[model samples]
Target chain A: MSALKRVQQWATFARVWHIYDASWQNPFKSAELLKKYLMGLHKPIYHPMNDCGDHVIVINSGDIALPGDEWKRRVYFHHTGYPGGATWTLAWELHSKDPTMVLRKAVYNSMDGNLQRRYTMERLHLFPDANVPTNLLKNVSNQIQQLKAKPKRLDHYSENQVKQFPKIFDYPKDYILK
Target chain B: MLLNMNMIVPLGILRNVLFQSKFPIRSMRIFPRLQLKEIREVQNEKELVIYGEIVPSERANILLKNTHPQACPLCASGLDVKHTDILIISQFVRSDGCMLPRRITGLCRTQQKRMSSLVTMAQKAGLMPNLNPANSKKDPKKRFQWKKFNKYFDESTIKS
Candidate 1:
């Protein structure tokens, strides 16, 4: 394909991904896993030199889940190196202190921590609440699609099978009905 | 002469208790399974007195912390739960500390694993302190009575 034709083709096929910040309900979802999926890192077309990454719009980060009593039990430690330099905060405490920050840190930590990481992460929009941001990307033509909810089954296999075997366990002639 | 009697009398009594005492002494100690619940509950306060021993507490804490779901070291979710909240963390064995499984907590296996890793990490991080009194604290040597040595060994005379 010609360069111009390929560019147009690429633009047409370019996708945006919308990731629900189900962290509050599903905190076990690793930021690392999410980053890989959102960054197009798993794709065959991934180019280290080019910004071939997709835009990822994350919503409801404030509600992100952490696996255990980690919200309370785990302590994050930091140090200033002075005599009283070290300080720590419990996971739940940090969430309460700044829920957005707790998520931001997770997302940031998931990145490569290089110069390109800053630019790549810039393409990611993390919202503390479920509401989408209007300024950065807005509800544009390139907006990501909402997730398809899983289908539920109303009638079960057992009920359907009942027609074929009306009385699956037939009582013997000598057996009492009671 | 009186002072000599005071020393000699107790020494004689001690010797009798040690050497003259019959082998096995026909003594019966009712260990009765030595269960804590069977023992009368002491009115004393239940405190986790951590004095000097650091290794076992560190190990237990790491094990407990890693096993806890809410405080898992492997995932981000546990960055918010409590160390003792078994709802977010658990162990194979039921104890005063570990949380029960998710059928009780209503959490899935994913969350459970995350919580457990966090708890284990915390234990490794020394966040969970050793809980046993013997391991947690030791009496100041000066305050420990020499009489307590009787608990560990039988008194015997040395023939020079």
Candidate 2:
């Protein structure tokens, strides 16, 4: 066999596994990363027909981020095919109903609709929390870097720091602000 | 009841008598019946009588099989991971800045993949913060400022 053919054979057979942390990152950003891995776009052996993609295990899907007022303005719609069957759900409502829905939708939309896409999607696994099965964790070869760093919460601040912070304005003594 | 003789008189005899009295010179002429009889005989031999009424057959009504409704979160949302869809990003990430799993989020495999990637893109674009404000070491007052970049001019083209 030719050397090139032998290398191609290896590329077709070998598969890698990846673990991605979605905590505090925007869902759209996460999807761009997943699209690359799922479609095998990052690999030299990547081809449209070849299933050279690696397995992607996503953890902390519940902690994805949103930039602006999408929680109030964005809406999701559903229809039951009957009279008055249309249902319009706000993004917040959908997320509350199912925390993984937003992430799932984001990823699904990024992929092209085809048999290969479906097969690649089968390799994706999602977890809301960090409790992953040992068998799957054993297969994880690497961890995909998160696009953004998580912001600290107010409760995480030290008591001394909070007290040391300067006041923006002072209220007059005995003044009724209300 | 009295019977009228005129009404009871036979029409054939009355016609013969009237014809004989009116003009004995004219011989009685008979219409031809051989053509009529031949046609009737041929029709009787060829015609077939159908006795029963024809009823059309009906097609069977087969009941359709029921399918399970797709309850996957990704399939239900019908939204893609775009920079503008901030609502999805916020919901997917938790208060502690961790992603929710399929068990809680109820997304299919494909959707989970897409969601994570979109989140990463949003973070890289600086549309979303990497860390939660409350948990970060940076001062909250300086945290939300947008980044600005200055345009550079070519040194070769511009005179100092």
lDDT of 2: 0.58
Question: Docking category for candidate 2?
Answer: incorrect
Alpha-carbon runs more than 4 Å astray in model 2 = A1-12, A160-178, B1-160
Worst 10 residues of 1 chain A by lDDT: A168-177
Chain B alone, TM-score of each model? 0.25, 0.38
lDDT of 2 by residue, B15-113 (tens): 556666755545432223211111111123434222222222111122112233364545554444454344445456554455656654556787666
Highest lDDT, which number? 2
TM-score of chain B of 2: 0.38
Docking class of 1: incorrect
Shift in Å, residue B146, candidate 2: 24
For model 1, state the Cα shift of residue B64 in Å.
40
Candidate 1 per-residue lDDT, tens place, A126-175, comes to: 77676775764453444333232211111222433422422101222222
Question: All candidates' lDDT scores?
Answer: 0.44, 0.58
